[model samples]
Target: MFYAVIPAGGSGTRLWPLSRAGHPKFLHTLTGTSASLLQATVDRLGALADPASTYVVTGVAHVASVARQLPTLPDANILVEPSPRDSCAAIGLAAAIISLREPSALMGSFAADHLVRDTDAFVEAVRAAMGGAEAGLLMTVGITPTHPETGYGYLRCGDAVGDGPVSRVAEFTEKPPYDVAVSYVESGRYFWNASMFIWRVDVFLGELSRQQPELYAGLMRIAQAWDGPERERVLGEVWCTLPKISVDYAVMEGAAAAGLVGTVPGDFGWNDVGDFNTLGDILERDERGNVVIEAGDGPVSKPQVELLDSERTVVVPRSGRLVSAVGVHDLIIVDTPDALLVCPRNRAQDVKKLVDGLKERGTSYI
Candidate 1:
């Protein structure tokens, strides 16, 4: 059986004010759906994997909120990390735990806050990736590049693997300069690295051991105590010691070098929703191209947003008070009870700077 693992660990600082440390972006309903992004991720996983077998690796602070959001997930399946240790550790822990239970189970790791417009295409891509996974190769879903996107990493694919659409990964490239990114798109061999990987738990753990032996050893030790009374104690002692690295750096890159990595191309309207501008792209806009997202599900009343002569603007009002914009063009306005963020839509990625500036101001502001 295929098990889906969602590493729910990012704070999404680029989406700040609306997305806070206490309440991250994945917990918000950014897609205008009744369910939050975390719930949406689980719901998407239900297309291939059973909810009972699905797992979410999130931080200690968000455990209660995650459990509250996904009531159907067993408490045991919600693996709580004492602190944020990045994607590799979060996914590695889940892999180790699943290995102990089902050694040969296939697992797919997907982010919690991404938006996939076409679920059928996503499932088809995942099924294709599973072919590579069953063959014991580290499989990743690569999005067909719609444009020369300098912000995302690129995967240079080689030949097809075993008569399938899946291809052998030639090289994994970091986010390139704009000129180089344009060349990558023109070449057509490059695909955006979505970080959606599928592989057998045993195969993944084996690769982890081959690439990052220390981390693998640490995870195995913790997994040994996972079902026992010493689970908390062992996890607390070992988890923090893990190297703060991404799975791309710690394993996938090395595995690609060793010719064990493969990728399946996918183009189903995927958006990472990293910043307000990208979020605006997926959201419904008015005739003048203004997108307004009202606060919902909170104890507070719906926030009233009034726009006057605003064009191509994105307004997120969470403060319950009426937010009125006058003569603003191509701007992003996000209001919370404690903070207000106003910047040009082009500068949406810099929202993290405001979040960082809050650190010097006070914890209450953050």
Candidate 2:
């Protein structure tokens, strides 16, 4: 059986003002649709399996919002993490739960906020990755790089496996420099590390036991308390004690070193949707290259606007607000109810540093 575990806990500080502590980026309807990123992610997985087969691992803070967004999902399927323990623990917990129910089930770990255009191709890629996992290989879907993107990690692929399109992962590089990324794309030897992994429950658990014995022991303790009323209590204890590490650092890297590697080429037009610039790139931009997202109850009035010499810019006006731009070029103007972010287009990625500064100053307005 094929099961999906979506790790929905993420602090999307980069998309601030629109993404806040109470409402994270996954809950934002950046596409101007009624569905949120988390909801869309769940809907995408529903095409591959039943709602019962899909599980959401998230923080306790967002449980209510998640439940409200996805009413079809069962309440029990929502595994609330007591605290943030990073991806390794989140995935390990999901694997442990699936192992208890279906020993032979193949689990796919997905980030809840990624954007993909083609659901059909995503399903196909998942099937290919699952096939490798069923054959006792730790499988990951690597996207064919469209450009020399230094923002994302790259996976060096080895020879083809049998007649399938899947390839053995030669090595994993974490966010290489510009020249190296360009070389990787030019040589046709690397793919963008999408972080989408597929593996059998027992296979991942065995690897965890072999590589991270301490974390495995802690997971075992939490798994043993699954049937008791002390489940949440035990999980809280484990959350505080387990080391904070990503699954790539803890298991996949080690498994690759141990010669158990598999990969599937993912050409599903995937993007992390990390920030507003990426969101603008993904969405349908206006003639002026602007992407606007409006939400909540607000007055709508069209104001006469005239642009003198604005070129190559994106202007997003919040719902119920009148915005008029004049004589602006190569700027991202994001006007929200609480905060307004105006920055050069080239420095859009660095907005996260501004958010970090706000966080350091303990300013909740951001």
Segments of candidate 2 deviating more than 4 angstroms: 296-309
Model 1 misplaced regions, further than 4 Å: 296-303
By lDDT, who's the top model here?
Answer: 1
Report clash pairs, candidate 2.
Answer: none
Q: C-alpha displacement of 341 in model 2, angstroms? A: 0.6
Task: State in Å the error of residue 77, model 1.
Answer: 0.2
Candidate 2 on 83-135: residue-level lDDT in tens?
Answer: 88899989998898888888868999888888878889999999999889999
Model 1, 55-125: lDDT tens digits are: 99999889999999999999899999898888899999999999989998899999999988888999999
lDDT of 1 at 61: 88
lDDT for model 2, please: 0.82
Q: How close is candidate 2 to the true structure, as a TM-score?
A: 0.94
